[model samples]
Structures are given as C-alpha cells and as structure tokens.
Target chain A: MNATLNKPTSSTDVAQNGANRVNYVTPLANILESKDGYVLEAEMPGVNKDGLEVIVENGELTIVGRRAVAENRGREVYRESRAFDYRRAFELDPSIDTTKITAKIDQGVLTLHLPKAEAVKPRKITVG
Target chain B: MSIIRYQFPQVPNWSSSDRLASLRDEVNRLFDFSWPSRDSGLFSGWSPALDVFDDKDNLVVKVELPGLNKDEINISLDKGVLTVSGERKQEHESKEGESFRSERYFGKFHRSVTLPATVDSTKVSASYKDGILTVDLPKAEEAKPKQIAVNVA
Candidate 1:
C-alpha cells in the first residue's frame, strides 16, 4: 500500500544560503485513492491562484505556492505563523496517468486529481 | 502515526531555517503526544495558527484558515481580547475510497489573544483573502504614541 502511494522528494533541493535562501513550510496534505486514481489536497493558507505552480517533470509532481509578504502593519506582539512559502514534490508512479492529471486552487487549498493509467486500472474479466 | 510522510529524515547538512523548522516540528510532536486532548470549552480539537502585528496606528491579526468559507469564521473583540473561532468541515465523506495519508485537520477551532494596547472596538475591521483572515484594530486616541515637549523653567 505504501509503495503505491507517492513520496515527497528531499527538502534539500529548496534550501539555500544568504539572501537567496528561501524558507518554506510543507503544507499539510491528504491523499485519497479510489478505483479511478488518487486525489491530493494541500493546505496553503496564504497562496492565491496566481502564486501557485503545479508542474509534472521527470516523473515528479511538484507544488510550489509563493505567498506575498504582508506589509509591516505594526510591531509583532504575538506570532505563531511565519512568512514562509509552501513547497512539496512527490515522485510520480509509473501506473499513474501523467497527462490526465488536473489541478485547481480554491481559497488556499490546491486539489490535484491524478488518474490511474488505463493499463493499471482494474477491469472485470468474464469467463467465456 | 503510521504515515511515513510525517517523519522528516534527518540529513547531515541543513540550512538554519530548516534546523529551526525541525526543532518546531519536534516541539509540535511533543505537544501532540503529551496533550492528546484537553477538556476545555474555549478550545476545540485544533486551532488555526495566527500572527499578531503591532504597528503605530493599528494592530493586525492574521489567522490561517484554509478551505473555509468566510461565513464559517467568526471574529470578535471584547474587553481588549480578540477572539477568532471557525469550523473546517470535511468537504467529502467517501464511502469507498481509501485514504493513503490524511494530515489536514478538520473541525471547530478557537483562539483568543489579549491586545497589548487599547483599540477602538467600534472601528475594528476584518478581511479574508487566500484563506487568511486579517483583523485590523485601530489604536484608540489615548493609546496612540504622543510626544510631549518639556518646557524649561
């Protein structure tokens, strides 16, 4: 069951140093599997539709959400949230149909529908 | 607990922010295990993360509440305390699909913070955008910083 599920790539790819270092938080995600394929939902609170990027390359599905930093309204008295972007990438499985994958962002949640390849989909066989 | 994605692998090289993030993750894990659930009327199963910014004229409070309709959220300021409460109801209840990994939280949440300075409650305004709710509390006339000149005798 775990092998069929996608795994996120290493976080080292986004880490950098000095002024170029872009800090990010991994958005909470949920993966649901049905007969057709998988549904992935990621929570990215501060990202708008324009700031989101969903790309499939090299057998990997990468999601990056760029959040606009709010202007300094006043001194920070109490803070639990940080000004970090959201980024996470998953290795695509061979059984998944890459071309049929569709994505949409509503509010701050990004939903990706990854359909199973036709060859891997379950089929009922009738005995002749 | 069986989810492998939650456990971030410890690598040799880590950026400063990554290290801090790991530390925070560890702290969150500690709290999650230590206090599984507390019987409190003011709080619920989960609370949205928030930030409070204090500026000269107005104090801004931002809360992260993704996938929630604005109508679901309720904000109020009473007696110098700002309270934010909301419910994140599950959108789908699949009868057949199996969940591989479920990490996002759902249900009612509550959080309240005391204001550092006096604010005009009547003039308080809130706006929601991109799943973030921002409440602006303008400082009262007496709360605003005033520079008084000293008269030399």
Candidate 2:
C-alpha cells in the first residue's frame, strides 16, 4: 500500500521578490515509486512545457515556470484568484542516477522518472 | 421603574461563505501592503523552480508546465533579466464532489530570473517537448574559460 501525508508550512523567505505580492502559492508535488523507477508529479495548471523548466544542480532538483495572464477583457474586475511563479525544489538522493533522469509534462501534471542504477536493481541468483 | 433584559445570539461555525470572505480579506491585505511600497515594477510573488549546475558550454533551465499550450508561453530577455510568462485554464466538468482534495495550481504565472552573468541572449534557444520547457542560455564569448600554455626551459 502506498500512503502519503500532506503537510503545510509557511515558507515566506523562499522567494523575496519585491513587487509580486502573492503569497502562499507554492506548487505541490508527489513522489511515487514504481518497479522501473521513481516518479515525481507536480500540478501546474496554466503552465505549458515552454514555460516549465527542470534542472539538476549540485545534487538538487529544481522546477521553475510562469503563467501569463490572458489579454484584458476591458472589464473592471473585482477580485482574482490565480497563482503564478510556481517554484519547488528537492534534494535528489545520491543512489539515483542523475544522468538517467527523464521528465515529461502533460495536462498540467509534471512527471519525472528517476531510474535506479544498475547496482541498485534487483538481481536474480541461480543455484546449480 | 422597568427592567430590561437582552439575549445574545449564539455564534455558529464558520460557513463556507464566511471562510471565502476571510480568504478574500487575506488576499486584499497582501496586496495592500505590497503594491504601494515598491518602485521597480518588480512584483513580489514570482517563484520559479530552478536548478543551477555547470555544463560544458552553458547553463540550461528546465521548467515544468502542464495543461498549457505551446503558443501561450512567452520568453524574453531585457537588461540581463529573463522573463517567462504563460497561462493555463481549468477544464469544465459537469460532475462535482469527485475530488477529495483539489490543490492544483490554475491561472496566470510570471517568473523573471536574473542570470548569474551576462548571457548571450542572441544565441539563446528554447524548446518545449512533452510538456517540459527547456531554455538553453549560452555563455558569452568572453565568459568562457581560457586555457593557458606554459613552456619550461
């Protein structure tokens, strides 16, 4: 059985850019394990592959992207509730092979496949 | 002489409307405090996922954005700052109550990144494949490392 828990904590200092005032709009991600590899899924609703970025630096994984506002409708709007600048980071495990990491984004869900190294894969022993 | 008595109404649990109202208030407060204080059009809430590493030629930025079409994303560079922005829409579904928890991000997002060094923006290229956006920022000619040769007598 695969069980995961959700935890929410305030991260105010992560992005300190001055003009953009939206807060508490952090991207949520989930990590899953499969027989072939570990998969990471992130929800990025309005972002496309062009705006999305994935990188590995110094044993850390980072994903960055932006959501552009639509053309003005020429109507006065009272309130808006959309988030931008989805940022998230993770510390990659040393056991995983960084070179073999593969990622894909579909339908606002980003999926990453981290295949296990040859030494970590399960091996079958034969008895004569 | 007359005696007067007043009975106070009991307070109820916060209704959905009340919760939504409070959420709106909180959002308003954020804007009130942040908008009037900055001079540079630099907005405060852009946070993009970034990974920095050394490559053979340049530093690459890969971002993940799903549910967005290729035409929606825009990339531009001005005065050494890279700006990426796009929008995503929500699908319409007739069915309701199907989701136990819904926290997926929706709407417009903007991210402006300041490069560590001057980049060769002319040679920069971006590609989107399989919902992943990859931006290759080539290092400037002068920024590339030079090797020196030494002769010993």
Candidate 3:
C-alpha cells in the first residue's frame, strides 16, 4: 500500500528547453480500502475533462492532468497558484483487477475505483 | 516563456499531516501580510489561493476552488474590494470502507482583495470553469494609463 502513492516523473523523460521545462506537481490524493477493492481520489484544480488521462500498463497506473494557461491576462500583481501540470503514478498490486478499473472526473477531481480480482477475494467454503 | 520545475516530495502520511500543513499555511499567511504582493487571507475555515493580474482594460482575478457546485459560491465587490466566498462539501460519507489517505480540503472558504485601480462594477463578469473562478473587472476609463506626446525642442 505504501508503494501505491504519488510517484514523480523523471526530468530525463521530458523534452526540456534551456529555460522551459514542463513542471509537474503531484495532486493531493486519497486512497480507501474496502472489502471489494480500493478507491483513489485526486484533486487537480485546473484540469478539465479534455485534459485528463488515466492509463494502466504493466501493473502500474498513471494519471496526468494538463492545465490550460490563459494568455494575455496581463501583468501579475499577485500570485499564489503556479502554472504547473499534474502527474502521479502508482504501482498497482497484483491482486487488483486492472480490467475492472473505472475512472471519472468531476469539477477537477478525479475518482478511480480499482476492484480486486475474483481469485483474490475471500470466499467461504461449504461442507460437502 | 519559462516552465517552472516544481515538485513536492512524496511523503506517506501515517500521521495527520494535513493539519500540520494548514498550520504552516497560517504561519506563512501571518508573515505574508507584510508583503502586499503575496496575500491570501486570514479565515476561520480554509482560504482559497488566488492570483491577480491587470492589463490595460481589465483586472483579472482567478481563484482555485475545486469540487464545489455553482450555487455554493458567492461573489461581491464593494468600494473597490472584491470578495469571493464559497463552500466545498464532501461528496459522500462512507462507513463500510476504511480510508487509507485523505488529503483534499472541504469546508467554507473566503478571500478578498482590494483592487489597485477603480473598475466599472456594473460590467464585472465572472465565470467558473474546471474548478477555477475567474472574475474579470474592467478598469474605469479614468483609471487607464494615458500616453502623453512630448515635442522635441
């Protein structure tokens, strides 16, 4: 469970300019474990449905959210929010049923449901 | 023109780190008031972070408030001060499952900023998209920067 948290992207993997390297911030995430499986929720404040992607590959889950920068807004008098994208990866457990995983985004929050594999679920045996 | 590389360390929160973070933010806010360029606010619940920008015609303010319904937000401008207040409620309450991690903030939040220039209050427009609230306040005609021509002797 510890390994399934936020994972940062390596600098080498991105196309970096001398001055501009795409910045990525790990979105705040919550994970819940139930008898069925795990529920993961992430907060990506500026991302829209068109800019979100969730991929599962090689027993790993990755979520990337792109924030569209509005240009020509003018000279900034004050700033607290930074212009950055969101990226987080998680190493999926073998017991998770990747095929049954589901994801949805609403109001910049992403919720993912990862169900456990049938063979991994606890089953009660009856006397013959 | 430049991309910023900002990455936060990935720390597992076996403890209540969210409370610690909010406490740190409060401390920062206390010190931040000395610098007008960086001011969030001192609110009881949570305060949403915002940015202020001014072009020739308009002053644009953007606030980050995620997972909130449109009706939950309230915006008002009085005497050159713009205030944005909102409430973000948790979507669901579950008792059947156990939570491993919870990091998102849910509560009422309020933020206000005094405009640098006078704006046409009637023409102010606001829009909420992708969990971001953008308030566009058009500067008054008299407050716009005027260019003067000088004749060379």
Candidate 4:
C-alpha cells in the first residue's frame, strides 16, 4: 500500500530540481509546495516594495532590494545595525511555467507563486 | 537650573554636550557603518543591494529598495561621496494577531559611498522604477580609463 502512494511522489521529484545552492550571506528563503503551485517566501527585513525587484531572465529568477541607512545629519546616535542591500537569485526548473509565475512584495517579505504546467499538474481521471 | 547632587562610587563627571556626542557616536557605530557581516534584527542584514559597474566613461549603480516611499528617499553626491538615506515606519496595528511576527524593517538608514573617480554631478540621472533605483554617474572626460595598446617591433 505504501508503495502505491510513493510511486507518484518519486515522479514529482524528477520534475523538480531542488539542488539550487542556498546563499547564507543573504536573506533566508522558504519554499512550499501546494496542490496547484509552489510558493517562495523570502525574509527581507528592512526592504520595502519599492526597493524590491523580481526578474525572470534567461529562465532564472532573481530578487534584489536594499535598506537605506537613516539620516542623522546633525542628530545624536545610539546602537545601530542597519544593512545596505539584499540580493538573491535562483535557477528555475523547466516544470515551472515561467510566464505564469507571479511575484508580490508586501511589507519586507517577497512571495512568488510558480504554477506548474498543466500537463504536470495532478489530475484524477474518471471512468464511465 | 535646579542642581540635585547624588553621590555615586567611581562616577566621572561629563559635560552635557560631551555625553550627547558620545551617545551619538555609539548609535552611529551601531547602525551607520558599513554593510553588516551577519543578520541580526530586521534591517540589520547586509547584502550588496547596489551593484556598481564601471565601463570606461559611464558608471552605473543599481540600488534595491523595496516598499519605500519615493519622497522619503534621498540620493546625493557631494565631493565624490555618494549618500543614500531614508526612513521606514512601523504600522500601529495588525489583523494577524495581538502578538505578531514582524520581519519588516522601519526607521531611517543612510549609506555614504565614495566614487571611484570624479563624476559630472550635473549630468547624473537617477530613475526609480519597479522598486529599483538606478543612478547613472558619468565620468569626467579626463578621468575615464584609457586603454593602452602594446606594439611589438
């Protein structure tokens, strides 16, 4: 019984390449798989929507943004830890429909939705 | 001014301005320095948001700024030092929950970077679109790097 359920899981793995090297130097990201698509969540602490860029070029996805240092022209200062920039990139798999991928930056977190191709989506067949 | 004296052990007297200056220095040391080496609190992680590429006569700096208001951002170049500064504010309430998980950063931040060579500040152009700030710094005619070819006789 376990073998039957595992058969489909093995094929899904073949369709996805999860071997992208994680860059610890930048923000940490979490990838989630759903019934219809995959979601990517990146933690961009000081970044805002205006500072973020999501680009799909040459079949690769890249996210870039920066957090500016606060102006203290003539003011006194205290403990500080503001960072300059945030940049990350990922090579996409062929199973993902690049044209259908959508990205939204809300707050400092960037969320990307990559919809699987119709042929790759799981479907239940009916026999009359 | 009313003077109240309280005796403490091993306490040195410091002037008000001196104390304030020291405090300011401490804050600057903590927040206004170079890119952070590690991720700490929100806005504390460092990444090269701006990648500057120089080719002969032109210099391009691509800056990444997300969710920041245009009016709040200021970019200026004076005496060869390029300064970028802005502020971000936190929201008062949230529907997620009374105790919320906030990874977003809010407050002021500034970065001052010196240019590689003399640039024509008047000819500089900056455009912010799609959450990226691209600053074009045109180099002076004499400052552009010249390619020298070697001839073997």
CA RMSD of all predictions: 6.5, 20.3, 8.6, 16.4
**Sequence-dependent TM-score of model 1:** 0.80
> What does the lDDT read for residue A35 in candidate 2?
41
DockQ each candidate and list the results: 0.45, 0.07, 0.44, 0.05
What TM-score does chain A of model 2 get? 0.74
Worst ten-residue run, lDDT, model 4 chain A? Answer: A3-12
Question: Candidate 3 on B31-130: residue-level lDDT in tens?
Answer: 7566444324353256566789999999999998877888899999999999999778877776877777766766777888889999999999998888
Q: Provide the global lDDT of candidate 3 against the true structure.
A: 0.77
Which scores greater on TM-score, model 1 or model 3? Answer: 1
Query: How would the docking of model 1 be graded?
Result: acceptable
Best by TM-score: 1
What DockQ results for candidate 3? 0.44
Q: After superposition, how far is residue B96 of candidate 1 from its true place, in Å?
A: 2.1
In angstroms, the error of model 2 at A2 is 21
Clashes of each: 3, 23, 0, 23
- lDDT of all predictions: 0.79, 0.57, 0.77, 0.56
Model 4 misplaced regions, further than 4 Å? A1-128, B1-48, B147-153
Name the regions of candidate 2 deviating beyond 4 angstroms: A1-128, B1-48, B93-99, B151-153
Task: Judge the docking of candidate 2 as incorrect, acceptable, medium or high.
Answer: incorrect
